[model samples]
Structures are given as C-alpha cells and as structure tokens.
Target: MLVRRFKKSLLVLSIAASATVAHAESFNRIASFGVIHNLPEGTEQSQETSPEIIAASEDGNTLVYSDSPFEALGFVDISDAKNPVAGGIVKLDGEPTSVAIGGKTVFTAVNTSKSYTQPSGYLMALGLQERDELVRCDLGGQPDSVAVSKDGRYVAVAIENERDEDLNDGEMPQLPAGWVTIVPVENGQLQCDKMTKVDMTGLAEIGATDPEPEFVDFNSRNEIVVTLQENNYLAIIDAASGKLVNHFSAGSVELQGIDTKKDKMLDFTDSQTRLREPDSVKWLDDNRFVIANEGDMNGGARGFTIFHKDGRMLFESGASFEHQVILAGHYPEKRSGKKGSEPEGVAIGQFDGETYIFILSERASVIGVYRDTGDAPEFVQLLPSGMAPESAVVIPQRNLLVSANEKDLIEDKGPRAHVMLYSLTDAPAAYPQIISTRTSEGTPIGWGALSGLTADPAKPGMLYAVNDSFYANQPTIFTIDANQTPAKITAATLVLRDGKTAKKLDLEGIAADGQGGFWLASEGKTSKEIPHAIHHVNSTGEIDRTIDFPKALLANEKKYGAEGITLIGDTLWIAIQRPWKDDPADQVKLLAYNLKTNSWGAVRYPLESAATGWVGLSEIVSHGDQVYIIERDNQLGESAVVKRLYSVSQDQLKPAAIGSDLPLVKKVLVHDFMPDLKSLNGYVQDKIEGFTVDAAGNGFAITDNDGVDDSSGETLFFSIGKM
Candidate 1:
C-alpha cells in the first residue's frame, strides 16, 4: 500500500518561469481569500466576489486568480509563503478569472454578466514596485481566452458571446455575433482606443446557446485563430485588422470534474456524462493550444483536448489513456459489494514531475491511483477500503493523503463510503491499507459507515467521521479510533438528535472541536423538507440535547442547498451549493455558527465559478483558517476521479475560541487515493466521498466505490498531520 498523507498548508511548488511566454512571468501560488463561512444564523456564508476563479492558485507565492468580474490575473505578494495575504487583487469591467502575463503587463480575459453587454478589454502594466491598475477597453460579450503577439503590437481577445440567458420567451440565447477584437495597447493603455471586432453571426443558425466566436490568438505569423463554443470550425481573423479570415473545427474536448472510475460518492444521471461544448482555450506554446471541453457545462468539467494553431489535433483527454483493468468480467461484472455503487469524487496531484490522479469506484469498491505523463495517463492498481469511498486530496507539502467515507445503503451500490487513511512515504508502496472497523449495526451489518471523515486537531490517535445512519434514513455521525491497529475498530458512535435512528433523518457533515470533541450536523429529514441545519454535538460523538439546527439556518431546500457542514474557529459553516431560482444572487449560503455565543449570523455571497450537480452538499472542512466544502453531482452517484476544492476565509467561520493567538484549522491535500482511477490510469480505483478536519487541524477523507468484481469491499487509509 502506498501511504498517502495530507500535506500541511503553505507547501507550494513553483512553476519555473518560462521564457517561451515572451511576456511571461510565473503562475500564482497562494490565494488566501479573506472571507469566512462563519455566517450568522438565518444567514448565508459571507462572499464578496462572484467572478468564479478560472484557476486555483497554488505554491503560495504568486496569485493566479479570477476576480468577481471574470478575468484571471496573478498577485505577486503572499504572506507566510503559505498563508497568502490577498497582497493585491485586480479587476476591470469584465470579470477576471484567467490571465496571462506578458513582460510586465498582464492580459486579462473578462466577460460581463447576463444583465449586461459589451465584454471589455483589461490591460495592466506593473511598475518597478509591482503596483498596478487595470485599463479597461470594450472587447465584446463573453470573450474567450486571450493571447499576445510576439511583436508586442496587438492583444487578441476571443469572443464567443452568444447571448442565450435571455430567451425572451424560452429560446436559448445564442450570440451568433462571434467575433475577435484586436485592441492595441501602448504604455498599458489601449493605443488603438478602437477595438477591431470581427463578426460571426453565422453560427446562430445552429441553435447553440450563444455559440459565438471564441479562441482568439495570433499564430506564429501574428495571424489570429478563433473557435466557437459550438460547431467544429476554427474561425481565423486577420490579427492586424481583426477581420474574419477562415472558419474550421478540428474535434472537441470533454469537460468534467474528476474521473468516474476512481470515485464512487456522487450522484450520476445517465450511465455517465458525455463531453459537451468546450471552454477555456489556451495556446500551448505558439503552435499548439489546450482547450477544456466542459461536457457537463453545468459544472460537469469532463475532460480536455490539445489542438494546433491551424486546427489540427494534438491530443484529447481519454479514459483509455494508460489504464489496464483486471476486467471483472466480459463487461466489468457490475461490482458486487455491501456498499452500492455510490460514486465518490476524484483528485489530481502534481508531484515528482508527474500528475498523480485518483478516483473512487464505489460499486467495484476500489481506490484507484494513476499517473498522466502529459501525453497519456496509465492505470496503476486498485486499493481496498471500507464500503463506499467519497472524496480525497493530496497535499505534498505535508506529505499526507486523506480520504472521507460514510456508511449508508442506496440502490444496488450497497452501503455508503467510509473514513480511511494512508501515510505518504518517500517510497511508492508506503500507501496505507484500509483500517477495518465494525459499524454500530453489528448484525453482520452488510455495509459500513457513511462518511464525513476528518483528522483531529487536539488528540493524537483520534478522528471524527459522520454518517446518516441515525435519522429517518437521514445522515448521522461516528468517531474512529485513530491509533488502533489498521485504525482499529469503529468504536464509532456519534450523537444525532437523541441518538435514535429516525427514518428520513439527515446527518452528513462532521468536524473536530480542537479539544477532544467533534461537531456533527444533520439536514432536515422529511418534515416539510425542513431547511438543512448545523448541530454542535460534543466530542463524545453525542448529539447536543440543547440546540436546534433548523431554527439556526432557517434552511429551506428550495432557496439554498445548505447540504455540507464544517467548522472553522468558533463558527460552524454550512454550504449552500444550490441557489434558489427566486434568488439568483445568492451565491453561497453560509451560516456562521458562533461557538461562544452559540448563535447564527448571515453572510451571503454569489459565485463566479461553477458548482456541482447540486444534489446534497456533502461535507466541509477547515485547513489553516481556510474553509473547504464538498458538493456532489446528482442522484445517479457517478463518482468522478477528482473533487472540487474551494477556499473560504477564516474570518468567515471565525472559530469563537481563537483569540488572535491561535491558528484556525490549517490543512491541505497532500495525497488522494480513491476508486475509478482507470480514467486517470489507475485500475482498482474507488470513489472518494467525504472530508473532515479535526481539532488539531489535521485532515482525513472517506472514499468508496463499486468493486470491479461487484462483490468485494475495498477501502484505503490517508492521514493529515503527525498524529
């Protein structure tokens, strides 16, 4: 077993600056957003910006972030190298998410929101001091990625704006006006002052929602290449005049979250998701570029593709890249395990000059690990775990690998995921095996525990995991013996409203109190679909005989998707992944539960990034004053290989006990092993499902998936800190 350990926060690996970028700097590292999930009762999480981040910043040095408007840029100053201080953030008329720095000036690709028009151009020239302001120029609606000219004379903006949001009646908005705009900048300001916009209204006949012109960039000769979100043709525009040159399409990339073969905790719709329209087109060196074809545009992020500047194919993401499965049978034998095939999530890691990918395949019930060599990915093998595997992460800084698992029964997949760990070592086989534990249901209890696993901050041999066993089939809680051999017996017991198994009850999220206790939360079972709520069950793993969560969040399934739970300082944070149709502005609904006052405050925010399938918010964890939330795709439960990791401010979940002296939970992904890894090159992979953080700030995750044979149970182990 290869020991997978969760790394500590601040462990960032810098990407050596490349001279090929011509006007290139470096990738942003640490991005410590100053917001908190600790919203008050009857409120939502505090969020300031909405421009979703096109890329997450790592390395804790430079910041590659997308601000509220939808533009991506880099920040130079970071605090503690690990604890990044929002040193400098920039934005313009367009939202900032993806940015490329040339020389000292940063070219940002931004797009306006639905209620507006006219995507704009943003240019920034960093002075010797690194202080800069944004110079905005009109680009067009919903621009694609941006590229710079080697001659430093022009900046190309890809415009694929097909207004599809406002259907007037019910028609999908398709901005047939696909065009490329060339705006010249001298001294960091628009020199042309006049943007040369190319016209592409022809695609409107195809009926793609706003399938406008996209992929604007200059070739080696300074000629521009543009592609649309819809259609196969790449439209070429005259770089100098911004005139339409030619149109053609090679193939397409598939956009997805993680590999399904590795993860087994999420809800899937059909057998699986297919590739959809592509987004995020980047030029790979001058001739080749990479495009992420978001299959499930609704945040499904399936896979990606590489293309040549002349509309030729380089490579596309493939499930069959380097995978070799044992072949349960003629067609995968439908893994038969106690835990049904409830797909977990997936994870991607960059280490040892290679990309380590993992997934949780609950049905086959194995944790899969793989490696992608940039050209193609290859399958490694399948590890064992408890029942179902959910979510996992790999943080190299701390040299740790953690997974969260839960126990439950649904459909044929068998039981829910479980909590497991593996200590990452210098060697490959150091991966830890699953520590078998007996569930509270000892009647030869078929499956294992539902998961919301997290490492403890205060104790050495302890961990807190959650389950939905206690409620009317609702989620519940559990505690594991961290020091026991193979993680010892479940010795697991968690309190849920009177400690009775009520039908239709919901208990999913769990976090450590930093002292010897734990925090447990539950969603409303079935009563009028009471809004999801948070509960601060003590460390004894018992439910609080005192407070009520429903009253605290005033949660309603209709408005907010308050499904996931976590704790950051004194605040108990709840995640609302689904926004209410009536209230589109509600980006994040986080209820800051004050541990001291034991009260709830409201801090709501909107998001520019995408979301999961929006079933039940899965789990929440805090690492280094930052809060992380886990969301599932949908009910079908098709575990993808990787999971989505987002960061929130410690101020949001202000753990009431911290006095300016102590630190909030600080944990990060060091290693992630799960199911369904073949998608990423690993065979025997399982889905990683849940996540947890203990009092000591260490991290742990639970993962599960259908087994390849369809009759086996596999779980793996992963840990956070020294304990």
Candidate 2:
C-alpha cells in the first residue's frame, strides 16, 4: 500500500509539473472582497462577520453568502470580475448556515436552535432582487447545508441537530435525530406547505439512532446526497418523493507518509488507519460523488474520497493532496495530530468542456484543483485561499470560482473574512511562487515560516533560508534553487549541535560564511530561554562555535533581537528587529561584529513611522556597494503601510561602542514591496521577512507564513528583478 501511495504521489507531481510548464488554462485569483465591507452604514466595522456558504444569481452578476456571526445574508456585485463591489447585506431573523440560489429566489437555511436538545431552524426563501423574505418553512431542526435542484424544482436542506461538545465530550446519540427536508419550488416561489421530512434514523453503523446529516447536494437525477458527519455515514434520497434510495458507511482509509505528531516538526513518516467522517459532499455526476473527509468526531482521513454512489469507493486521494500542500510550503504542521490540511469543502465545476474538482484544505488555506478523468482524478494545480474556506461556488458561464472564507480574525487584528474570486484563463498558475522537491526517500521536504534568506556568493540563483522559532524543535537551513519558476527548496539541512537537533533557537537570519559554511542569528526570547546570540556552522549543519551578545548589549536586550545578518569582509552585520531599552523611539541598531577583531559595535538606523503598528527591520543583505534591508510594519491587510526595501551605502559602516551615541546611517528607498505582495490578489502579508540578492544581482524576497497557525499559510516568494 505504501508503494502504491508513493507511485500515486509521483504521478501527481509529474502532472502538476507538466501543467505548470505547458501553460495549461488555470484559475488565478483576481480579487478579494472583505465581508466587513457589506455592512450597512453606521455599523461598526470591528464587529465579527463571516462569509461561509455562497451562492450566485442565475445571471452570475451577484453573490450572496451566509454570515452566521452577524445574523445576516451578505451580497456582492461581481459583474466586474476583476473588481468586486459590496452589495450590502440583509438582516435575517436567525443565523444563516447555508444558502442556494434557484431561479429568482434565494433559499437560505437558517439555524434558530434554542439548544442541541431542542434543535429548530427554518428554510427561508427570499427574493433575489428585492431582498424580501418570500417564505419560511420550519425545518424542526438546526439546518447545516442547503442545495437547489438542477431544474429548480426542489430545494434540500440537511437538518443537522448537532451535539453539544461539552456534553459527553461531543459523542453521538444526542437525541432529536436529524433528517432531510425537501421543499418544492414553482415559479420562483417556495411551496412551504408541501415540504417533506425524510427520516434518516437507523441508517448508519455509528450513531444509528441520531443521524446528524451534515451537508446536502443534488444531482441531475434529483437525488439528494447527504453526509452524516459525526455518524460517519452517507445516504441518498429521492428529492421528489422524499424516499431513501441508498445508504452506506463513509468507510475508513489507511493513510501513509503523513505527519501524525504536532511536535513543531514536519515529519511525514507516520501512518494511521482512520474513519472518513466526511463533512462536505458534491456530486461529480449522477452516478458518482466526492466527499471531503473532514473527520469531526473520532476520525478524519486527512484527504478526500470519490464514490460510485453504489457503495463502491472509486478513488481515495489518501495523502496525495496533503503531499502537494507540503511541497507548496502550506502544510499546517500544528494540525498534524488532528488532520493535516483538513480537506473540508469540495466543489465541482464544469468549465468549457472539462470537469474540475476543487478540494479545499481548511487548515492549510489552499484549494487543490483536479481534473476528473471518470476513473481517477488527474492532479492539476493548487489555489491559495483565504483562511478556513468553508464553501465554494463555481460560475461556469463567467469562468469564475468563488470561495467563502469563514474565519474572521478581527479579534486578533488579522485579516477579516474574505470572499476570494478566481478566473479560468489561458495562463500558468501564479501562486506557489516557491515549492519544495522530494527527498531521496520520495517524501516531501516540509518547510514553512521562512524568516531569513541569503544568497551563495559564487552561485547565481542559489539561495538559503531558515525557518524561525515556529518550528523551534527543528531549526533548518533550506537550500533554494531560485532558477526555477516557483523557486524550489532542493534540500533541507538540519542545524545540529553535538550531533543532536538544536532546540530553543529562533533562527531569524542567515548568511554564507564564504567558506561553504553559514553564520546564523538566533533571536532571543528571555522568557523562553533562547539567548540572543550568533553561531557559525559548516556545510554539514554542525555548529562549530557560538557567540553571545556583549554585556552592554545584553543589559538592554529585548525580545526583538537580531532579525537578519550579512557578512562583509572580516565583519558581520546584524539588523536588530526593534529598538532596545536605551535606543530612541524611531531608531533600531545595526550591530557589527568583526570576526578578526572579536568585538561588537553598533550604528542606529532610522525607521519609517507607521500610522498604526510599530515598524522594524526584518532582513538585511549585502550586494554590490549597498546593503539592502526589509522594513515592514506588524499590521496586516489594509492597515499595513510600510513593507519596503531600503538600501544604505557600503561606505556608511561607521560603528561606535554600544553605550556611546551611535551615528544614524542615511537610507535610500530602494523599492516598495506592497505591489509585489499584492500581485497574487491576497491581502498584503505583513511579514516580508526574507530578502537577498543573488550572484547575478537579481533580488528575491519572501514572507513568513507563521507556520500556518492562525495564518492563511501563504508563503509568497517572488523576485523584484535585478538589484
């Protein structure tokens, strides 16, 4: 089985590589619509809002999404595909869980459950143009997913009377068993009185008495397929007659080459056999469907599976999709123990003449696109998405794909919930500007949180990067071949001390020591026992010597220590991330340590004043006659104002004693990184942390994805051309 899985992964890589080189028609993000923008006038923007499940009008000109936190249905005008405008929101009586559009009416499943023991909800039909409630059918349970029939004759809602997690540890059999509700629609009007409740009790091996129907979808045959998430089951019902046609266990999968430990390391040598507690179900055709094994209860297969609807598993993705995610540097290492990547949403779209399946990884914040070949799906490309994409809608006529991201980080002051737009065009995929190649054992080189970078002196397009404290247990230097289109991480060398993996080191900066070795800077957090120091390592990744901060500097050292280091002649310069205790408000130190003299001195560098957050240096590199530095603010998205590259002349290397008044060096604005960060249409990432100029004088930079912890898991690595 392991050999088969390995072969499948290799095939996927080959297909992905071919797709990239052949310039195959791909989907690229065009714009992002923040759900907060849909709030009405005078409404506070800081309030939490989310776009969970989305639906589009028949004309494909407008979008409507369910916002449960705000208890409203949000809309957007996407007629201008490249530029989306807020269409305001309509207040709803209950929390909208899912939405679907049929003809001129919008059908929404609203959960009004008073409690899990007495679950209740309603299916609301509203006028798409007038935004008026047309009809409301009491579903008698908390609704989760809603789907409209192809002929616009029926609407199906999955009544998921979910269990309270606090009770019995969220085990099944929490009574008031859920069922499927089918309502007839005629002439854009819902016949609520004719709504039929399809009983779903005694259908699964697990939770047979309490069937928690999670998601619903309809095929061309008017057959409703619903996933019983906690029950680990699936059932098919005739929408017209509301009769059960078939039911079966969602089954289990034995996963290989997967990371099963959340030890702050990306080790993919573990294996597990888990039940596929599928979350979202989408019909590929009348005879087949796909399920995202999100694994709510005791099981999550960590991938997706395709079924023939006749109780036969056609294709199980296993860990192939997660492997691709690992290669793209978007793997969520923290989620390894639960569900790696966590495929949560599945979307099927028929664009032009080809059928494409989009598998959304909620934890990784990426979508895997695959071409359905009727037998086995062919791997295509991965699409970068907003945080925690819960659902997606495809508009074939407009060649557009939309994802409703459900995570709103307003409380953390991060990017808000977003509705991301992608278009199918005759071009190559633009995302994943950096990816990793496989090891000799055919395992992906898992990497993230690229905090610092440096170029090889004699090798053009060859660079090295270090992962920060996010993976504190496994500090590594990744060799990058920037000559590739999406620069490839060719190898990963673990930084070791006494033949053991180094610990408690927050490697934030790296520079080649000119003798096939490297000089590394470890940013210290006094509270965490990691010291502010520098280390010299050979090509074999073994630390030969370590240097601690001088007494004068250590006395005033802050958590924000050395962020970047660059070697120039006999001296090593380190860029301090933030101001120390004795420094001026708007100035940070650029410390210099001479290898031959064995001493330390510093010069202050002026910072660009930020309107909101504090600004600091992230990276520093020496090229030609100048030293390039990356200065950025801690703010994300629209609040960010300073993510720039500045250069200081090499002749300005005047350093004084640490306690003495330091001379401030003059800086020249080399480039504004806002445009490059915005090129992929994602919200501007705040951590433009790594920068380097190769031997060819080409400039390259990267952002730290924070190890996909509360982040979108997008590590943007792009070149700014020649320096």
Candidate 3:
C-alpha cells in the first residue's frame, strides 16, 4: 500500500505541468487586529471582548465592528492597509448587534432589551469623520442585523425579538414580535422621522405570528431581502413602500458523507435529512441573493443557498462546502453533533471585474471563496479565519477582505479575538500549507494533531508522522508526501496492540527502527495513570514490545515526561519535556534505553530559560553525528519567545548509568522558528512539536493543533530547507 500510494503521488507530479504566469491573483493575509487593543485606557486587559460584525469606510481607511461583550463599537484605522492600528471604541448604552457603512456615516443597531418578553432596540447613525452619534431612533424590538443601500439613500434593520433558550427549550412565539425597519437617508445623513415599520408577521410557516428576522441586505433596485433564521423562512420587501414583495420557505436539504457525532475522529459517512434554517442573507444582484444556512431551531444544512427574488431556488450547496473544509483539516469535530462547519455569515464583492462570494464557517473558522459563474459557483480556495468568525466585510476598492471573529479566550489565557485582514494581490495562496489526499475508497486521510515526525530511511521526501492523544480512540501513523505542494498525507495506519487499536497512549515522538519498524515516545501524567513508556512497533503498526521507565527514574518523575525519541545505532534516546524532580533548574534529562542490553542510562541537557514561562523540549532526531531537538516555551501569540531548533554533538552524549551523576551535553543553536511561524500573518502558535531531517538532508517541522479543541485548528508544516 505504501509503494502504491507513493507511485500514485509521483504520477500526479509527473503529469502536472508548470506554468509561469507573469500575474497570479490571490488573497494573502497581511495583518491581524486584536479586539482587546481597542478598549479604553482604563479598561482591564483581561476583560473579554469580540468583534461580531464589521464595516469599512467608503475610502477603505476606517473599520468599525460591533463588540457585544464590551457594549461598544470598536474601530481600526487601515490607512496603511498592510498595518492596522487601533482607533479606539465608542461606548454605547446597549449591546451593539451589527454595523454598516454609508458614505461618511456608520449605522449601528443596539439591543437594549431587558427581557425576551419585552424587547427594545435602537438604531444610531454616527458620523465617520467625527466619530460621534448623529441621530438615534427606537427600533421597537431587538435588532440582529443592519445594512445600507448602495445609493446611500436607505438603511434596513432586522428586528429579531429573540427568545431566551432557557425558556421552554427556546421554542418560538415569544412576543413583542420582530419586524423590519426602513429609514430614509440623504447624503449619508440620517432622517429618523421617515422611519417605517414593516410588519413581518404571518410570513413564516413556523411561528407565523412572531417572526424573528435574522439578517437584512439591499439590492441595486432598493429591494431588501431578510432571513427569518429560526423560522426557516426568507422574505423580500420593497423598501420604497415598506410592503412585502415575495416570501418562501428557505427549504430543506439532504446531506450525505457527513459525520454526525462527537467521536474524537473524522469519519464522513453519516447522513442528514431536511435541514434548512438560514442565518445571513446577501444580495448577489438585483434578482439573486445567497443565504447562509446556520440552523437556530431544528436545522443547520451546513452550507449556503442561492435564490431568485421571485422565490425561485437557483442552487443549494448542501454538503459541498463542508466537504472542502474537511479536506483542509479545519472541520471542528466537537461540533459534529450540532452543525458541521456551520455556515453563518456571508459577503459578496466584485473585484477585477469578477464577483466573489465569501462564506464564513463559524465552527471550522475558515472562509470558503467562490466565484460567481451565474450558475453553480466555482470553488476558488479556503482562507484561514480566526476562532468563531461571525461576519465579514469586503473593500473591493482597496482589494481587501476582513473577517470579524467573536471568540475571546481571556478566561483561558489563550489567543484573543482577532479581526484578520487579507489583501488580494498578484501572489500565490499561503494557507492550507499541509493537507491530506483522499484514499482509494474516496475518503479523506483524516489526520490532525501531528505531534512527531520522522523521514523514511530509503524514500526521499517521504515522512511518517504520529497523532497525539487528542484522538485517544484513534492512534494512527500517517505517510506524508512532502515533495508535493502543500505536502500531502497519503495514507494512515492505525497503531495496534494485541490485535486491538491502542488507547490512552499519547504518542508524541516517532523514529524508524533499522528493521522496518518504529520506536514511539509516550508522554505520561501519573494523575491519569498513563505511564511514560516506549513502544516498539513493526512496519504494519503492530506493537511488538513496550518498555517502561526505569524504577529509579520513575521515583523522580513529573507530569511533563517524554516528548520525543530517536535511534542512534542500538540505543533509543528520549527527550524529557521539562525539569523533573531531583534535576537541577533549567536542565532536563535525556534518557537512553539500550535495544540489546535492556539497560537504562541518562545525560542532562541545558534548557533555555524563559522570562514569562517554562521552556522545554518538544522533539528530537538523530542525523549525521548530531541530534537535532526542538525547544520551545509554552507561550502563545505575541508573548512567545523561545521556539528554536538546536543540535547537540553525539560525541558529547556521555551517558551515565541510572541513579548516577550524568554529564551535561553542550548544544548549538540551529535556527529560530519565529519568522517561519509568523509567515502566515497570524499570532504565533506555541506548539512546535515535530522536527526531522529527511534522507536528502532536508529539514522539516510541524506543530500540534490539540485536535482543534479550544483552538483555531491550524496545523503548520513547512520545510526549513537543508540542515
């Protein structure tokens, strides 16, 4: 199977033709703006904040986004589009739900409702140049979305008198029912006196008397399209007269090849029936528009749909979009029980005489780009978004795209909520740097959390990687074709013990045995009863032996145990993650087990000290007369400092018997991986867990994604060229 997969990958490479185009257009992320930076001077840094919806000024110099947690509208200056600056925030009396730009003014919908039963909201128009409120009008109910007409003569707001989920399983019919509010504007100046309340009652089949509108958008003809998300309905209204033009059920869809359980693994074989609840709607033209089906009540189709203004369905994405997300390794397995990928928000923009549709996956944290062909949209590429992307806005004039992500991990001390900016330039795509190809059975390789890496001794550019314990139920080794663009995982082999799949083993390191097998390092935490051990497995992935830590070493063991392993002739050297008991400060033991003698010995290695956090070893590999190791700090984002690769001479590895005074090994700095990690234009990730030198002397590194659990689920795999 390995030979067959390798030959197939080579065939693909052989048949592909390279073209040298002088101009290549692609979107590349240039800057990321954290929402916490826009907080007032006195505000606490730990306060949670998020940017849910975003809009940009006419000249594409200013960005405004709604921050519900901070009860304000955060601003960013993008005059230098490559570098964005915090422009402060505007505190409001209520939670801002959405924002839109109209010439020199910004319109925001603020929800001030005290309870679900008695709802109230307000629409405020703020001057863009002065950053001050120009006018405010009572919107009768809590608003969910806001939009401005292209001509800058009208503003539309979707009043969603949302029900409390704690009340009766969150079934609809909770009153002070919702409606659409249309107001007149002249030269970007708000005219609140001309507001008209358009009743949206009896428009949806479910909860007909209490319509909860979710999103609103205006077409070139001044016609407004609204989505009643919870009720599974879409309605069109003539803004000039505030009268309903047409309405229809958003409609159900049948999906196959989907995983519908939270099973800690990716298996797209399940099927779903009749799911329609659409959330955000955007106009494609005067007669067509698209709706993102992010279910609220009983359905989430996991895709988007296009429809004509006269209630005609033009196209339904069904499971197509989510399939691409699955292939990209961005599918959120934890969200399988609810909505897979959850297509929530969408933005359509015309650039370079072509229309592009951007769909946001709230759970997967990716954006699917599609070109409008006037039929089924053409899939272009997928862009990596921050965690929980809720909305997006495009600035075609400046060739820019922005996403507003709403997940702030202040309590968890993880990466904060960010607004990512991408520029459309004449360059190649930079994301999805590593992905898996489909197997012969037409299923994705389904690999993630790549913790350890090692190259095949005979096959150049061919590597093997292991997944960490995040997929506890499925420990597997993957075969990668590193020579391919973006690198491809070609096959997966399940690690087995006693004829059954291995469990409770946090396999973090891999090294090829001289006899067509491998030695794997397992990290241990005594509290969980998982011991630090080494397993010897055959080429077919069947475990032949398991070696436990020496009793003397176990007596001084700590939670941070073995992280990496490598073979040097008849000896297996393992990297201990951090300083264990009985060890000196800023030093860790490199334990060695003899394959033939069955004896244990050790040597101490000095670790770089970190100013804010502890530094530790993540991976190790034996190449030439040296052992290369990855040492990094457990800090994320801008706080990360010590992600470096170092090498120690084999001659200095003078190991002493267990329980004896081990000699310290001197190391040489090989490279600092900070610049490579930041090349994607995102906050630096902390887990640089894998490193290996291939048979051709090329070096490669990979990061662990923690199985996309409480993470954006981005796996970085790149080559550091020659060692």
lDDT of 3 at 161: 85
Which lDDT tens digits does candidate 2 get at residues 672-722? 999998999988899999999999999999999999988999999988999
Give the per-residue lDDT digits (tens) of candidate 1, residues 38-112: 112343322232222222223323333344312323243332433334344443444553344444565666555
Q: Could you tell me how far off, in angstroms, the CA of residue 127 lies in candidate 3 after the best superposition? A: 0.6
Candidate 2: TM-score?
0.97
Error of 2 at 200 (Å): 0.8
Clash count list over all predictions: 255, 0, 0
Residue pairs in candidate 3 whose N, alpha carbon or C atoms collide under 3 angstroms: none
| Residue-level error in angstroms, candidate 1, position 425 | 13
CA lDDT for candidate 1: 0.43
Give the C-alpha lDDT of model 3.
0.87
Q: Residue 410, candidate 3: how far off, in angstroms?
A: 1.0
What C-alpha lDDT values do all the predictions have? Answer: 0.43, 0.90, 0.87
- What's the CA error at residue 159 for candidate 1, in Å? 3.3
